[model samples]
Target: MEQVAEKLGRPDAGDAAMGKAWGIWYGSDSTAKRRDEIAIYSSYRDTSMRVKDVKQIRITSNAFKTQDGLATGANLEDTKLKFPDIKKLSSYLNEKKDTVVVYDAKKEGIGFEFLKGKSISLTVHPVNTAVNDTYLTLHPEWKLIN
Candidate 1:
């Protein structure tokens, strides 16, 4: 936690996983059209309760892009061009009650959440780790998209 705070400056620790985990948020604001947020999740197993061994990172802004120029707000078809192996995973209602479709490139350790056919967020995890294997909490009522 200390190392990350030093390297990335300070982060706003937000409640997540029903207070079982902390989600360190960067550039997260309520009013911005593009929040440019990056949330890092730490292991719940860590006894220290600090951000030791970050587990997942979620990017919710278009400011960050893949090497191939894919970013949030990108078209699903466009993203498929850059990640041909990506496949539809599921669909869930976001905070705004908008239907968000999730897709994953399992081997690449990257996933995308699409709203209205446009990417709205991206998640990065350990290479080869399936999305289902991560600690991320998904809405239980979500429907399988593929």
Candidate 2:
């Protein structure tokens, strides 16, 4: 945790229980109000940390890109062009009242949460359990795009 904090310059906030996640903010204030430009989360098995997944939000710079060169701020068409195999799983209004589309690359263990016309966030996880088990088990209606 200290190493990550050092590299990311101290997380503005964190949730030790929620998959041991940390929110890294950009710009001044360093609070939730400033917006968590980046979110880092780790999965655990038994007492061991299994894997880490990093998510970025509203990132306009070209510093980060997917394996197919898709980046935040890109439109749905651009995502489809980059990841031809991408599959749309569902769509709903997010807490922000924005229409969010969820896309998944089941084989690649990657998922994207796009807000309306532009890509907003990207999440990568293990294929065996791309999403939280509790949520999946509880809401069987929510299916992954296979």
Candidate 3:
């Protein structure tokens, strides 16, 4: 925990929820106009807790991009062009009437959520993680893209 704080110049805040601990680093001027807040998640179980591995990374910044140049503000068409292997999963229309498209790059162990055809967030985690489980449960009409 100290190493991460030291490397990232100390987290602005942190929290614990859903069996995980999160250290959030708000962007600063030194970080090229850090407009996106970066969050790092670690496991918290019982009295034994350690930052052995990053459980997940939730990115909302446009500053960071995938190796293939995918980032928050990108459109679905460009995403498809950039990542031919990207799979289009089920989608849900939120209360705002914008369609939220869920995509999985299984090979890359990442999932992307797009709002109204524009990328909004990118989540890094295990490919088999149930990121869409709740959605599936709520919207059985939407089929998994396989």
Candidate 4:
């Protein structure tokens, strides 16, 4: 921590703040290191998500599919924030029979479209962009099959 604070260069000279300065420095370094580590690991995992190996999942509206007679939503929320698995698909369409594929990498941080009607689609997370490649499909399923 002291190393971090010293690098920050506190304005208050001769004020016994070396330890605090190092703390700031180490904090910044810790965050940076963690971010880098995540990026590296993500890259390593993405290599296996090939174009021919994506498990396809069809998207449906709020009232389309039923899992044990329950509703499931997979609505399109935004496009800018998507990290479509490029290796898995090309693009999402509104047409029927459109097949979409998503990687397990994005199983979290994704939201649903419960009780609403709008555009729905699926894409790989940003961390899996290379794996998804140009393949981010939009398939709508009218019914849920076991």
Top candidate, metric TM-score = 1
lDDT of 4 by residue, 5-53 (tens): 3554542221112111101111224434221100000111244533222
Clashing pairs in 2: none
Clash count of each predicted structure: 0, 0, 0, 24
Model 4 alpha-carbon miss at residue 131, Å = 9.0
The whole-model C-alpha lDDT of candidate 4 against the native structure comes to 0.27
The number of the candidate with the highest lDDT is: 1
TM-score of 3: 0.63
lDDT of 3 by residue, 50-136 (tens): 434466676778888888777888887887787666787767765555577888776666777887678877867666664443221
The lDDT per prediction is 0.74, 0.55, 0.67, 0.27
TM-score of every prediction relative to native: 0.76, 0.63, 0.63, 0.20
Total colliding residue pairs, candidate 2:
0
Error of 3 at 107 (Å): 2.9
lDDT of 1 by residue, 47-77 (tens): 6664457767788877888888888989988
